[model samples]
Target: MLNRMSDHRLAQLNIAALKAPLDDPALADFVALLDPINALAEASPGFVWRYVDENGADATAARPFGDDLIVNFSLWADRDSLWNFTYRSGHLDLLRRRREWFTRMAAAHQVMWWVPAGRIPTIEEAGERLALLRANGPSPEAFTFTDSYPPPSAPPTTAETGTPETATRAGAGLTPPRPASPSSS
Candidate 1:
C-alpha cells in the first residue's frame, strides 16, 4: 500500500480578467478588501505560499497572462487544505462577488496540479497548466475542483477500508452549487 501521506503539495492558479482599472472607483470596494483578505489567507491553516510581485504586492499587476488579468497562485499541503481555505474561509466572500470585479470567462480560468513538497511553480508553468486544461479538459496533470484527480502518491485502497478508493479525499462528490451568473461587470 502507498504511504498515503505523500510529500506532494497541491498548487492552484486562477486568473480573472478585471472589469476596470484597479484604481477605478468602480473597483474601489474590491481593492479595499485586498489587504484584509490576503492577511486572512496568510493566517489560515494549511496556507503555504502565494505569488507576490516585485513590490511585495499581490500579483494583480504582474500581467503574466494578459494586461487585463490578475492571477492568484498558491500552494497548500493538500487538496483539503486548499478547499478549506477557498470555501470555508473569508475567501468565499470575495468569490461570491467575483462578477462585480471580473469579467465572466468563457473558458476555464483555474487549474490545479501536484508538485513536490517545497517546490514552487513558475508563472509560465501555471499558464501551461491552464492551457493544458483548456485544451485537454481535466486530467491528472491539470484539473478543476469539479473534476479533480488524485495525487500521484495516493493509495489505491483506503486505509480504513480494504476496498479501493474511487473518489478524491478532498471535496469527494460534492460539487459547489454554481451561483446565478451575473452579467460581466
Candidate 2:
C-alpha cells in the first residue's frame, strides 16, 4: 500500500463493531444518518477520497475486519485536513453516539498512515496497517491522529506537532458517550 511515497496523502481506517445487524431495528437511526454524514465528509474541505460500496455510497457493506464490523477508509490532503473534518465537523456528533450503535472494542480500532498519492489502498492493506498500529503503537508505518507521524520525507511542523484540534475539541465541549437508554433509540 505504501507504494512510491515521493508524493503522499494521508490514509486512515476506522472500524466499528456493530451492536446489532445493519438491518436490525435497533440500528435504524444509525442507518438513517449514514447517507447525510457521508455526504458531509465528501464535501468537507481537503477531502480527497473515501472507500464506498458498489453503489458509490457509504462503505456500510465493507467488512474487511469481520462480519460484525464495518470500516470507513479514506484519504485526506494532510493530517490537519483529516483532523479538522473528524473533530470540527458534524462527524463528531455521530462519534459521540457511537456507543448507541457500536460495541466497545478491546483493542485499537483506528489507524492512519501515509500512502502514495493517487493510489487506492486495498482493504487487505488497510487491515495490515491497522494490525501494525495495534501491535507496535505509533510509527511512520502506522499511527493515529493523537500520535501521528509526518510524511517519510517531510520535516515535522507546529501544525503537525501541535494540532489545532485541541482547541476545537475543547471549544466544542465534547463529552464522553453516555449509556444508551432504550427509550432514546
Candidate 3:
C-alpha cells in the first residue's frame, strides 16, 4: 500500500481534517461541512492526499466501527505545514469550535505517523496502530504529542529472506501489550 512518492512530491501534498461531524442527518451534511475546508486544504501548500469516506464510495474508509467514534487520516510533507494549517491557518478556526460539531471522544482523537514515503495506511491499520499507542506506547507504528516518534530512518529490514517486506500491519514489530493495572496494594 506504500505508493512510493518522492520527498519533493510529498512536500507538495496537503492533508488535514476535522475530528467531529457537524451534522448527523444521513451523514451527508457532515461531508458538506467538510467540503469547503477540504478544498481549501487541497489548495494549501504541502497538501497531499486525504482519507475520504464518501459513504463507502471512496477506496480508503474512515467509517467508525462504533457509534461514537470518527476518524480522519491523511498525509503531509512535514510537521510544520500540518501544524500551521491545524493551529494557525483557517482550519484552526474550525478546530476552535469543534465542540459545536464533533462528539467528545474518550480515546485518542487525532494522530500522525510517517508512511513509507508514499504509502497510504489503511483505516483499519491506522485504527489498530492508534490502539497500540493508547494501550502501550509509541514505537515506529504509533505515537502521540506527549511522546512523538520521528519516522524511521530506514525501512525495516528482514533477516530471514535478506529482503524487505511491506511493513506488516498485523502486529509484527508492534509494542508489547501493557500489563493490566495492578489492584491497589
Candidate 4:
C-alpha cells in the first residue's frame, strides 16, 4: 500500500474547520469517518508515526476560535502516503461527502511539511509553524510546497570542496532529510 513506500517518513499536517455551533451536531459523524480512515492508514505501508493526544486520543483539543469555527490538527508520515489516503484511497470516498460532515473552510485549512524521520512534533509547534508560514512566507523552519523549507535539524550542506552532502530539493516534492543515523532506545 501507499504506506509501505512512505516508510522513509514525512509529515502531513491537517486542520478541519468546523461548522457554526448551531449547525455542528455532526461531530459524531466526523469521528466515525476519521476513525476508520486512520485505521486504514496505520495499516498501510509507509505508516511510521502520527500525533495523538495525552490519552492517545484520535483527535486533540478541538480549539474553538468562535461559535462557528473549531480547528483540528494531525500529523502524518509523508505527503504521498497522506495523498493516497486523502485523495486516492478509501478516505477519498468520505472526502466526497465532506460537506455533509464538515464546514466549508474559508481558507486553506491544512498544510504539509517534512520533519526529521522520527520526530513527533507537538501541536503548539505545529501551530507555530503554520502561523510562521502565514506571516513570514517560507524558510527552513516553516514552509509549503509552493515555497518549501528544509527540516530545521539540518538543511543542505556542502563539503570543503563544495560538493553538497545534501542538495536543495526544496519545492520539488522531495522527502524530508533523514538523520545521519537512527536513534537507539
> Which of the numbered candidates is closest to the native, going by highest TM-score?
1
Question: Which parts of model 3 are misplaced by more than 4 Å?
Answer: 1-32, 53-62, 155-185
TM-score of 1: 0.80
Model 2 error, position 19 (Å): 0.6
Worst lDDT 10-window in candidate 3: 8-17
List runs of model 1 lying over 4 Å from the truth. Answer: 154-185
lDDT of each: 0.84, 0.81, 0.55, 0.56
Off by over 4 Å in 2: 1-6, 53-57, 154-185
Model 4 is weakest, by summed lDDT over 10 consecutive residues, at 1-10
lDDT of 2 by residue, 68-162 (tens): 99999998888989888889999899999999999999999999998878888877888999999899888988999889887755322234344
lDDT string for model 1 (1-185, tens) is 32256678889999999999899999998988888887887888888898887677677768888889999898888888889888998889999999999999999999999998879998899999999999999998999999987777543454565655544566256343366989997
RMSD of 2: 18.1
1 or 3, which is superior by lDDT? Answer: 1
- Order candidates by TM-score, high to low: 1, 2, 4, 3
Question: After best superposition, candidate 1 residue 115: deviation in angstroms?
Answer: 0.3
